[model samples]
Target: MKQFCQTCLAGLMSVFVMFGFSISEEVQAEETGQTAYVDVSVATLWSEPNETRPVDAPSIGNPVDMWEWTTGMSYEQKLWLVGNLQTQALYGQEVTILEEQGDWVKVAVHGQPTPKNDLGYPAWMPKSQLANDASFSTLKDIKEFAQVTDPTAWLFEDKHRSDKFKEISFNTRLPVVAETKDAILVATPSDGKKWMSPDAVSIYSSQEDIEKPDGQNLVDTGLKFLGLPYLWAGTSGFGFDCSGFTHTIFKAHGITIPRDSSVQATHGTPVERDDLQKGDLLFFAYNEGEGRVHHVGMYMGNGKMIHSPNTASTVEIIDVFESDYYSSEYAGARRYID
Candidate 1:
């Protein structure tokens, strides 16, 4: 009886090994709650796991080739991304893994708000772009963080800036490990640690420590991207869509807003057209302001607004009433900031 029991135990252990399951691994997964961080400079979230096309290969590469990804797409291909490409998450952003299928994972991005999920905006992204390091979960406890203030910044492997680690987009926040007079040591999602120049970032003790900027500050930040080519569903300095441009501009100032234009039109304080302030969000609809909300722009005061209009346009300032299309479809405005 003893010999038979030993054999059975050995067989069970083999089965566990074959299935790649262990007590420690199970405990680690439970502790982490399947949390992962974006490992790439920008991880594009898709409406579905299989929504990517052949031309999207460059966008998914390890060091995402944003330039090739944008310049390579044809006009039609760019328009196709309007609905199929959901949104994007910057490097080091935390996401709660909801589901996994093959090489893709459905995650709720922490900062982006949406009605699709109470946790955050829901979207599917390639699994390879995420880092599942258990150590990264501890970042939530770190009070001090370094936020990228510039349009773009490079992460260095050393303080001397000898080796380039990665080029991160604006608004990317990472837990600060240490700081020097000219550089900051930050904890990365995949890479162990990297250094950033103080000139490109601002240190905040906590999210509450960030001082809120007024409406004009928002416009000043938006103005930096003038002439940047528009990209559908883009949320990085490399490119931006209509709502993405507004969302990123607000996010850089420590404000969290909805990820979609239609959803964004619902929240925030409603402002009358005559009372519109600089940085107020102006929305547009399908049927002369009566139909579904489809587009959004930041009010630039004096009858102008800044927006990434469409795939064919760049980040430009335009007279809101200059174009008949926008004037006829103007849907009211909303104020996210007081």
Candidate 2:
């Protein structure tokens, strides 16, 4: 018996994903800032097909990624890589380069939110590289980089000297696939750079295949990080913020969604608030007079939503239009799943 959400498109089933985690590894993410970390099934350039790995990890030795990282990842970002393996660029432009805090440092070209010029158009700016070393393995490395000073400057050169992670070869230039000044040099032997698991799992409980799961998969995969500590700008099952969670959940289902709620809201068709449905997006604006959505959440039917509220609010369920905190600031709603 398929339970259709009365509030949804007449035939759409109300997906009730109960995110839960085990005692040893319940990873839950918190929404804090504009940036976050994400762990996902990446199609790497050298991962092997049969390389024993978790569902979310890139196959060892398989050349080129299978489009793993959540789609619509803002280019001006810093992602925590778990392995010492070099980055095999597939797309996007690289701007700044350096090593900081034992992680591969980078400055990316992506869409950044900015106030309107005379045209009321949103422009892309080179945002600062935030050092969010949550990748257990990445946090252990000393190859780090940060976008400092004028991060908006697209042409920022770097020459870093870290005491940690011994230089494997200074003369040996790390091959950068992209047309960026960013160069990679092997760092000193740190702890274990052996983390290859992307920490992926099927979102469906009854499904057997790890590669794909139908509608149930989204909810099941989301529940994988039931209790992981929330981190701002997160986008992986290992730990994820609000948009990260939504992005990861949809990706597993073969659905491509923009990385942030603000962006995701634009990908799908608009729906009236009174006619909202399950899995739809609900936006909010604290400064209502400004009339711009500053926050977003997943409309989980029954007047509830699943989102990592604010820095203070944990990733939990609450009434959508009824929540005293959300209703007053409610901006609008949209849906992607047709």
Candidate 3:
């Protein structure tokens, strides 16, 4: 009887192994929920299942309290990237849980895009970074809110950065409950009422602002972050990835585009390199004739293009044909705003 029982147990374990099921996996499956927000200062997105890399970390200027550290981020533009990776989602960016693979969770980020037949802005992030406290919703909700339009806008307890309360990224939309002449009162989920400069935000009255497809002032809006540092996978002015620079630039002008360079390459009408105009998106690859579209830039006429090149770089205008590296890898151009 004992020998028969041992054989049955062995068969059960083999069955479970063949089907790729484990006791711990079942526990994680039950604990994982739908949507989650980045609770930390910043959450970095990963390309593969196990990948998270930090970029150019800023020198921690004279140590100060939380308020000073948060406040100085605006004028000094320092101390924010201490231990963060380049491809990051700011504090409030929402992500939806798709599936759980051990300690990693495959998620689809809001406002980001993936290929047609694939999941939405699909990426794998550590399950620990996912939080359950905050609720995630679409950007079109019928609330009178102020959309952040600067590289990093500080929400002050009073009016200016001197009385800084908190800091938020460029694309983060905050609910506006009241307004003063110089500042707008915004309601945040984690923090209560906070005041921000009126000029730093664009107030939306109706859904027209969200649905508008015209790239009215994209290039001009993009030029605002000329001196900002480049972070990997960053989608806001606080720090911008190459594609993130294009994504947020278009968002400010009221157009929704894909998030990644490769996916964005498949968007918009194709244009010839010789016919490139202002506001047209230019992409690059590895080889001379062919490679995966890995980088993107916005043409600013005069043979110049604006891009957040890499982790050690900042948003800047560069000659498309000036450097042999960029000129050689030039893939093609696409016009999103016609």
Off by over 4 Å in 3: 1-22, 25-33, 39-41, 47-86, 99-106, 116-119, 124-140, 158-162, 210-216
Q: Against the unseen true structure, what C-alpha lDDT does each candidate score?
A: 0.87, 0.37, 0.67
If ranked by TM-score, best first, what sequence of candidates would result?
A: 1, 3, 2
lDDT of 1 by residue, 87-172 (tens): 89999898989876667788999889988988788888888999877766687465488988888899999999889988888888
Given candidate 3, what's the lDDT at residue 265? 90
lDDT of 3 at 229: 73
Q: Residue 56 deviation, candidate 2, in Å?
A: 24
Error of 3 at 331 (Å): 1.5
My TM-score estimates for the predictions, one after another, are 0.88, 0.41, 0.74
Model 3, residue 67: what's the lDDT? 31
Largest TM-score belongs to which candidate? 1
Ranking by lDDT: 1, 3, 2
Give the runs in model 1 whose Cα sits over 4 Å from its true position: 1-33
Q: Per-residue lDDT tens digits of candidate 2, residues 219-260? A: 444445555434345443323456756765664454656656
